[model samples]
Target: MPSDLLAPALPTAQLPAHLVASSTRYVETGLRGAANTVRAYAGDWKRFTSWCALHRLESLPAPVEALAGFLTELADAGKKVATIQRHAAAIAKAHALAGHDSPTADKKVKVLLKGIAREKKTRIKQAAAFTLASFKRTIRSIDVSTPTGLRNRALLLLGFTGAFRRSELEALNIEDLAFDEEGLVVSLDKSKTNQLGQAEEKAIFYSPDPALCPIRSLQAWLRVLDRTEGCVFVSLRKHQHLTTRRMTTKYINLIVQQYLGAPYTAHSLRASFVTVSKLHGADDSKVMNQTKHKTSAMIRRYTRLDNVRQHNAAKELGL
Candidate 1:
């Protein structure tokens, strides 16, 4: 019989060697999920397998009862609803990849997830958004005489103007930038939202003040880099010598915190852009154009004007 024909109707471990190898190859490359997502799922699956091993239970084609126990244990361990949800998704994908039915589809598992969410009553935290005035002030305060200063200023300005996620910023390249008389256009090959390698562009306009102009700051930084290609942002040496290596997402966050100071993460740049634009009367569509957000609901979520006075219609009641 052919190797595929000899594939056993058993757990993943008991499958024929050739069948297992083929399945492993498909799992690694045939999935539609993003690289980060695939890595996360792999991690979740590993944890689940470890848990199963400790309990002397089968991991592949996991029983619904075992899944319930696993999720319950996770919830009892104070895992967040979002984290638990991701774990469930990981388990589901693992079973699907192995040609087995996902026990996560069980009604009991669904109810368990719902109950966990209800009992936890937890919410996702939003990044702190600075005012437009504060942003301008911070931008102006950055001394751009040095190479480090030039790069930092450019990174911050572009990240805010483009409403770019840290990953997007990290993935940016010199070839992706195009300058025009009006402003600059950044072309992205892919992003967190755009996993299919769609052609997307973000426009950053020139500021009246040279000090706050993203194009000017980027130009200065690029002059320091002295190359027409490679990553837009990169690592620097102790003496501020630039390296060819791209900046990591964690390093980007650290840089943001370094310059913007406490409580402001890299996400704050994107959030503040949304909040400030909304406050200045930009509608969801306008904001979406820059942020490349697919939904108005996400735009609303990103708008972090915490004060009631920010956008209250109560004042217009004409009492």
Candidate 2:
């Protein structure tokens, strides 16, 4: 929750004790609880409150008609359907927090959202996959002589082969990585999906080409840094010493965007892993093991473009 949201509008003594406690605890908690989710929810709330302020409307315990007006405003502005949906969710969550009945379920609001969805024709935008050739070229281009380059190379390789999300990669520590003759093992204590902290392990075996091997890249980086514990990927300046401070998703995004194209973000590496593997006939189950995707539905979305006629089941039919 944003600090303003958490800050009591009125003194605690002015409101009921139960309301104060509920607003403090659950108002900012969001639909599904995660660090990233909570942060996004806070942003959504900020936008909603700002809109309300502009219209001279009370955001807390917002009325159903006013909520519908908000949706209409968003639709008129040509906001994406997904964005409008999130706005509704933020309003609902805010009402819930203030111990008031939410207007999200009202018939008018539902109709407004349905109309917006039909008009916007919004579909989820899958990150463009980094082609295998492109991936190889990107890796080759990295000047590993510099400390910064070495870290970027190791980060890119591990993130790609392991099919790790930006948060997962940033969360990794030296202790999370273990190497052997076969490959490397990374233990993730928590992830967006694995909220219970049930440890998950991802394996990245050696590639035939040492230059392309993620394991070798990581091993080389480890040798240079020579750290027993701390973040596996630390920020390094050009010719400057390494800092133990953990890296953020911004750095990861910056690295990919700079080396590859601006369209390719940090997620492109992970999506590319699934796409490249599936394109060559890797089984869905095996791919899920690396990607840690609980369902095959999302995996199919990532690899949809590769599932063409040549790779389709009908190709085997003697038609």
Candidate 3:
């Protein structure tokens, strides 16, 4: 029997100082924020370093001019402004930690940063949310009578219901799921934000509607799955169990493309949760808890209030 595919859970030990410091000096002391934020910043900073190296930049501690030039190059390459800004923020933090102020703070660097920020703001479009209709369309397109179909249905529902990111879905293990009277408890060992704030390990519980619950699909998967003791989701080849390696994030992307046709990613499921929750009057704090968002401002972006309010107002006007 192929062992279940699941990434080994990362221990809750503090990460190496050098590894963290490579991204930012703050990591030397420790990340005092969200785990997801830290990981993103780390990745962004590394990419900036790689870009700097490719351009033969004299130093990792280059001036704001170099940073500005890089941002321009990214924009010219057609990267979204938001993505470019994220790179800028990550590089800026690393530079600042290395005893340099933001190049933007310099009169010359300031001008370039301002230009990029303004230009990018106009170009960045907010992401769209996944609606119930969209979800149904994607699932209905799948032929769920087969094992692969069963796995895909369970995967889609779990992704939506748990608001799971691609990486999180891939890391899921059968042991992580626990059922109680309240609902299901999803024990995520490592997430985008796993190492943020105190760096302690914690599990998030997911409570889905019982009638149209994703867990029911998960249960159906468990019944037919060969290796029930390992990862919750596995790849099937001709109804034969393949390696028990957990599904990759890229596979999740491919799955999204197959079902939704395009312009949708795993993160959209998380955003969808926030959008729908807000539309249904879920409080900011409650939604934040579900989405694991640190701030209200970030949550506001996910909740498309203007559209919801407009639709509600039209109904009242009719009454």
Best candidate, TM-score-wise? 1
lDDT of 2 by residue, 43-85 (tens): 8888877888898988877877778888888889888888889
lDDT of each: 0.87, 0.81, 0.66
> What value of lDDT does candidate 2 attain over all alpha carbons?
0.81
Question: What TM-score number comes out for model 3?
Answer: 0.73
Q: Where does candidate 2 stray beyond 4 Å?
A: 3-32, 96-100, 306-310, 313-319
Off by over 4 Å in 1: 1-30
Quote the lDDT for 149 in model 2: 77
**CA RMSD for every model?**
5.1, 4.3, 8.0
Give the TM-scores of the predictions, in the order they appear.
Answer: 0.88, 0.85, 0.73
Ranked candidates, highest TM-score first: 1, 2, 3
lDDT of 1 by residue, 1-319 (tens): 1122123234577778778767665554444367667778778878888999999888887999889999999999999889999999988877766567899999999999999999999886678998888889999998888899999999999999989999999999999999989999999998878877889999999989999998988888999999999999999999998899999988999989997887899999999999999988898999999999999999999999789899898979999
Per-residue error for 244 in candidate 1, Å, reads: 0.6
Clashing pairs in model 1, backbone N/Cα/C closer than 3 A: none
Which candidate's lDDT is highest? 1
Candidate 3 positional error at 228, Å: 5.2
TM-score of 1: 0.88
